[model samples]
Target: MATKRWWVLGCVVLVVAASALAVAQLRKRDFQAICDGAVRGGSLRYAIGDGGIKASDVDELDSELPFGRLSECRASAEDDSTGLTVAVGNLESSSLMSELSGHRDLTGLSGTSAPMGGGWPGVLTVKNKDIAYATVVLKCGRSAPHEGILVNVKQMLVEGEGNFSSDKRKRLKLAQSGAAIASDVSKKWECGSQLGGEVDRAPDDVAVNKPLPLSQATGTCRAMRPLAATAKKWGITRAASTGSDSRAPAQDCVLSNSKGDRVYRLSALYGPLEAGFRKSSSSLFQVSGKAGRKEKNPGWAWAGAKCPDGSDAALFTASSIEHSKENKRLIVGAEFETKMLGAFARDLGGRRGCDDPSLPTG
Candidate 1:
């Protein structure tokens, strides 16, 4: 009798806890909620704060959504001086992201991107000429399938927005505002991930920055410095790089020839982007799912990293344009492509805190 009574009590507790969680999730937010949560500091004039703007004011524009979620969300300031938009879904589902209207892959967007940097695995794109947006991806433990719950939040700020005089000023407010909505959605949605503290400012992106001499390259980009002689044969020397932080979902290093043309490209891809890259990039990516592929015809090599636990591993690739072109004296020698591949694979995996990428013995 005592054993049965304890089991009944345990069941009741679990049921109550589950019910409370469900209720919290059911109280969903509309555009107004996005406004209220955009910047807790009341900095955004049109975002549920000062200037007589409130989230409730924006909710008036949207209907109560089912499950308290919208297929897509957008918030804009009066006079069109400022605007913000967001999309939430599994990172693997590209269809949902496409609905955001000008949002596709990060590479397709024209802007400089750098890590969000406050214990957040994301990037902020400051549009100099065309479209600009900030994107962050968070992984919640097993909330979604094989990968954790991945939510991408992008915030774009126009020049006329509050105090946004230059890209620097705009980035600061953009970080705070975007992080605010991301935090709210992650917690309210109960993705079971740790949300970090406040965000202060945006950091500079090294990858999008101007190319540096091979000798001056730092972090993961330094992996290729030892091969400068080999690259020189193909007229490749300078490198454009991203930060070395493994927490970032995406990272890149592009080797360019003296004339400022791409000679080789190297990258580290994680989560939602892993599949998209393989599909859109050259046919060489197909081998990324396995031990990696090597080819002398195209002068390319790719290596796949092993992730912790049972999750999918990160993918690394090195491809060169001039290496394969017909040039007896200037072309890259056979198997040297793999040398660059191995160098990048090993270096990138070390930086990202993953096991060494898979490579066949020479």
Candidate 2:
């Protein structure tokens, strides 16, 4: 009898192991399908500079969580006004408790709409009032059949109002419903990565002109160092090349006025209303040439910080005037336009960036 019991136990173990392995394989396949679908179906043009998420890797925000399984994976195809939104979820599991404890920092995320459950076993809160939400829980890390993602998304907007605390809870729950439209659609999970395609025509805004001093220009004719230093600090290893000169390598340059220099440019892009609501964007700026030296229209270049890390490096060039045209133009373009006013509406939004909470003081 004892011998038979041992045999049964061994067989049970083997079956469990096999089942685990099969589950892992299924999850991997599912995730891959999700990735492919995202790429094929999604579209959020506007090539990002170096910094956003990568193509193949999953961003923290996009991964499964709290412990659950994915029931659906699809993409939306819409105009730039309303981008595609993705929805994913997880299978119910007891292990979710452990996973939530492990990542408690992220779980009871403060400043969101709903207050964290008071020592509640499993719950999440959201702050954004404009959207609804959904919830699924999963463990962290990618393990075989056992590993997966649980995603909840904004489904729809809430209509009625309640008491302060009740309203907060309702809004939070609404925000958790992940069934509605998704804005800012893209294929990759990483928010830092850039997706190349087309962007809608951004609206215009009052021009801003931030001019720096002209004395701080550094580097030789071929390469500039001041702006290069800034780029390097920002993890940019490559240098920007411009002009017709092939013999000389690409280099970095800086913009200067008689006053001190400001490295980064801050700007905003208003939303659809075009009244006041606007997002922010960032860029690396460079200006060359002299105030009146009669050189090529004083150098004028603006590089957005939207790429992956340091990939797209474009140089600005203007025709050299015998004296007046390029000189006067450089002053206006570099000093009055690009530096201060900015290139476009979205340019400002790109500079402001997500998660940067500080409001721009007028």
lDDT of 1 at 22: 69
- What are the RMSD figures for all models against the true structure? 15.8, 21.8
Q: How does each model score on lDDT? A: 0.54, 0.26
Q: Each prediction's TM-score against the native?
A: 0.66, 0.21
lDDT value, residue 173 of candidate 2: 30
Model 2 local distance difference test score:
0.26
Model 2 lDDT at residue 326: 38
Residues forming the 10-long window of minimal summed lDDT in candidate 2: 272-281
Residue 67 accuracy (lDDT) in model 2: 36
Clashing pairs in 1: 207-241
